[model samples]
Target: MERPQQPIEHWLDLERDQLFLWVPVMLGLGVSAWLWLPDPQAWTSIMLALVAVALLALAADRGGRASRAVAIGCAGVAIGLGLIWAKAERVASPALTKPSAVQFEARVERIEMLAPRGIVRLRLVPIRMIDRPGRRSAAALPAQLRVNLPIADLPMGLSRGAVVQMGARLVPPPPPSVPGAYDFARVAWFDGIGATGRGFGPIELIAPGDASGGELRARLSMHVRAQVAGGPGAIAAALATGDQGAIPLDDAEAMRRAGLSHLLSVSGLHITAVVGIVMLVVLRLLSLSPWLALHWRLPLIAAGAGALAAIGYTILTGAEVPTVRSCVAALMVLLAVALGRAAMTLRLVATGAIIVLLCWPEALAGPSFQLSFAAVTAIIALHESPRVKAWFAARDEGWMPWLARQLASLLLTGIVVEAALSPIALYHFHKAGLYGSLANIVAIPLTTFLVMPAEALALLFDLVGLGTPFWWVVEQALRLVLAIAHAIAAAPGAVTALPAMPQGSFALIVLGGLWIALWRSAARLIGVVPLAIGAFWAVSTPPPDLLVTADGRHLALRTIDGEIALLRDRAGDYTRMMLAENGGFDGEPGLLSEHRFARCSRDLCIADRVIAGRQWRIVATRSAYLLPATDLIAACRGADIVVSERRLPLRCQPRWLRLDRPMLAQTGGVAITLATRQVVTVRQPDDRHPWRVPARAAQGSDNLCCSMQGLAKQRQL
Candidate 1:
């Protein structure tokens, strides 16, 4: 008999970490060289040195298993580093980009409509630069543009696979990030784009465009949507199709509030759901066939079909990064089963992860990639337990087996997935959904049964004369589904914005999740680490310095001499998320109230107006003060210090009001221009309201000064 194998371990088992160390370090070093090295010689030297060290380490570790480990790490690191270096160098090639416009021709690869901003991905067309008179010879630039098309009046005919041409400005995507900053432009580049543009380009229609990927894929996608049109259906379509575009923000909010957003997004839950669905259906169908039941291949066919169907569904739904990563992982597990090989467990995960990284290394930077992979790894180990699997599979009189699985799996799997992912979510999104489980329960069935199917059918029917009933029914169902989602979302306590959790919490959660996934164990107590840390972090986060309302009203506290100046009735989504994370009151609020600027409230800092003197100047205070102003002809002038507090009834020609830095810049004047143009020789030394007095200069100049000061105070708050 063969020697007993080590039971399959979790992906995060301690040994896996040892494996991970080499890859990340190697890749990180290569990335470092590419990012930090100034010259080609430095790049070559660093890479070679790192390679030599890694090789030496591998050679030293050569002693059966230990040697294998070293070699694997070294090889993995080498590959990752090599890839990063290639991409960096390709982008850096001096001849690759033209600084001046040259006439070119390229194909339109994609069309992304983000309401106000539409992203049209195109292969390069030639660019031509217009030489300016009296200008010296300069670098020639490419004549391409990533069109920033404003579609207040959106055009209808734009479709996938359509080619067109136009004139625009073009620039390369930005470089990789510095140690601790975002480089979004560089990200866009890796997504296979060069230039963006706006409005319609001069077009010559190449051909009538059909839905993406031909009939079966498109039809299935359409069917999935049609089936899930209403109730849970809309959610199903979202998860199944990556078509969250049609989901109303409010409905989405409700799902989020209820903590069921993942159910509607085809996450690990969806992948696992499909896998179970395929496994059960395949086994049952085979059992029914007298001849097929006798053959082991019957179940195998079922498994294959089910897996294919799930993958098909994923493809129909646009196969977003999370879904794609999940698919890769699922496939890895399935392949092992089909080959009748002992499950590789963490090693399998490592293999799958390496495959994905090699294909899209840039995905490492995305939250979906992190969360999806992490969640899958956790659930894989959880499901591997005989006890856990038996419990889920055993008879339950409460509901249908499938339905029960749906519910249990949603909860159990969600718990596992969320445990590992909560930290990242909290750190990045800055809040945890308290009711996500409940949300998923309501959403799962709706998506699987109604929305995904309806949408799929509707799209199919659209192409054929026989699809009317399906289309109509799907549309009705979609309306109903969306309505319910909206209703649930609007309920009280539906969504509560929390403060930002720490990055440390998220990192720890990943670490703990990894641990739980890697080690084979009967009890799953260790899985609670992520949940515990996330909760503690969420609850303890501090209040915000500024809040911006959706309507553009901004609420923030500004400090002058440790006193807070409150800009009331203006708080927005961005500000709310920011405040909860940074959690500090830079200035002491004199007053706080609901919906107004008054002193002393329960919020982090009050939104009360304050005007206090600082060390450098007599900073005056004014709120809702009325002043006079005069207007002159074009040549005629105005006041030196013009302070427009709220608004003056009389137009001031030279309303020189001294404005404070409470309304303009969010930071102080430390970084403003030193050019001083306007000053007032005040006639009244002790006017109760010096701010009310209109001096003889321009209001615009005072506004600039006030903006600078306001900016300073704003950062503190």
Candidate 2:
């Protein structure tokens, strides 16, 4: 007889058993997404193996331990093999040292319907290095090619297997230089993109962008465009088909203000809508059949509807990374319910995350991926918490309870998400949305129900000749919504003050919070600790005074005696914290807008005069900094350097014989740069020193961090 299993062993066994074939398959797909890296062969090989492991696990469900173990082993080996293959392929590809711009015959692989920037992805036909190209090499396969369109023509749609070619400037991918941010090249590579260019150049229609079965999707897009009309037409197009090319920026903001911006993409809502429609159709058809109708067949219909909905949505959305991730998550929900297990939102989210990260490793770094998933995860987690549920549960039956629940959930979600992502958002956009929640409350819903769905309806009218009426109605409604969003966004206190959070601190917050919230057991428990630490850091840490950004990207620091001084070439007068954040940086938690930057710069000029009159000075700009100097003809001198964005200003200036960049940077970091040849130490113990940037910048260093543009240059200032 088999020995009795110990309690611990039983628990372990149960947990291990959760590792089904699909888990590995999903894992592999996620791993495959890393194809965005310079490793397609690896991802492809891994993808194949992951699929194999899934098959093995499923096949061994009724088998003994040995069989399951074997399956797991094979799967693991395949994943490893795939990774190795990717590495080899990367080494095999020639270093893109030669800058060759040419008109080549190529295949259009994919099209990204990004708003404002429509990118057409292409795969270059592999060519041999020799005269008579022998066997085609994977190295020559296009890993990067994109066509940046004006969203208008891009939303027209393309299918899988379309042929196209164009001109572009060939260059190496920008080297990784920023910490805790997404990679740009990998995004291109994953889509088989070799280069990005403007204009169609020429279009010889080899095939319809939609393939054999995508005709219906094409029809839907055309129909919706006709129904919505102008801006709303574009909005509905985005909703119906994941194509938002025509929607004006103002309209998009209105929907955002309505707190319903999520509806624009082909996410849960679109899937749900499609599933509902499909299920209704299928169930009614079954009802007419009479036989299947009596057997509680709705579940089967629901499943079928969900599957169909997923496929339809995928095609409509052009199957971008985010949309694909959402589709996979939705499938998990449907699958869990169908399998008789309670569909846990968090588990679905985790599963989806695993799928996304593994399949497209680059997405792990993208802000859209992070923010969308964050908001979703927070909402679901809050909804599922026993305490929160109970709190809402105890309420009496009335509108007050409903309203209270909505407000509470919103507040919790806003605080948690903003708290979680504020650092990263600032690090990337250089602006945080301080009053985003207030704007979202009024915006998200209005966009969701009023704008999105109504716009989607207009598409149907477009199918027929009479599309004007529906289109007109949507435009009128959209204008009102747009007006409201702008009015509210412009309202006083809609945004608040925030500047760039330090890079190191920002990274810690995102990594720590994500870990705590996602991981289970002891790991998950420790996650909240980071969040607490981050909150304290935020509230107590005062704003920087001497801030500098060069190459118009990287920003660097200084904090002053209760007032902030900014040094940037961007906008200023809009520097009110509220304007930057509420403008979309989540109410401007960190970093101000160019408009604000401009305003502040003007004021600084005045402040510099007052400061100079008192014999107090600070280095404020790359234009040799603000110093009091009287050479009697040759040199200008003041007491000392006040603030310095120039890493070493005086040395380059020949005025001061000896120069210490660190002394100035530290002093400037604290907005105390007031002396030259005088090395002043910053007293803040937590301040990290020398703050080296990744890519070199010849334009001078920024306070917060250097931008990719800043570093991609050949020279450093």
| TM, every model | 0.60, 0.60
Model 1, span 217-325: residue lDDT tens: 4344456556444434444445555555445455666566555566557765566566766677568867886877765676567658767866886776667677887
Residue-level lDDT for 645 in candidate 2: 30
Each model's lDDT: 0.47, 0.48
The alpha-carbon root-mean-square deviation between model 2 and the true structure, to one decimal in Å, is: 10.8
Candidate 2 C-alpha lDDT tens digits along 7-84: 434443554533442343333334334432233454556568666776877685653454455566556545544543
Model 1, runs deviating above 4 Å: 1-82, 90-106, 113-157, 166-183, 195-197, 200-241, 263-296, 306-316, 319-321, 341-347, 384-412, 449-505, 521-717
- The RMSD of every model to the true structure, in order and in angstroms, is 12.6, 10.8
Deviation of model 2 at 679, angstroms: 15
Candidate 1, poorest ten consecutive residues by summed lDDT: 665-674
**lDDT: which candidate is best?**
2
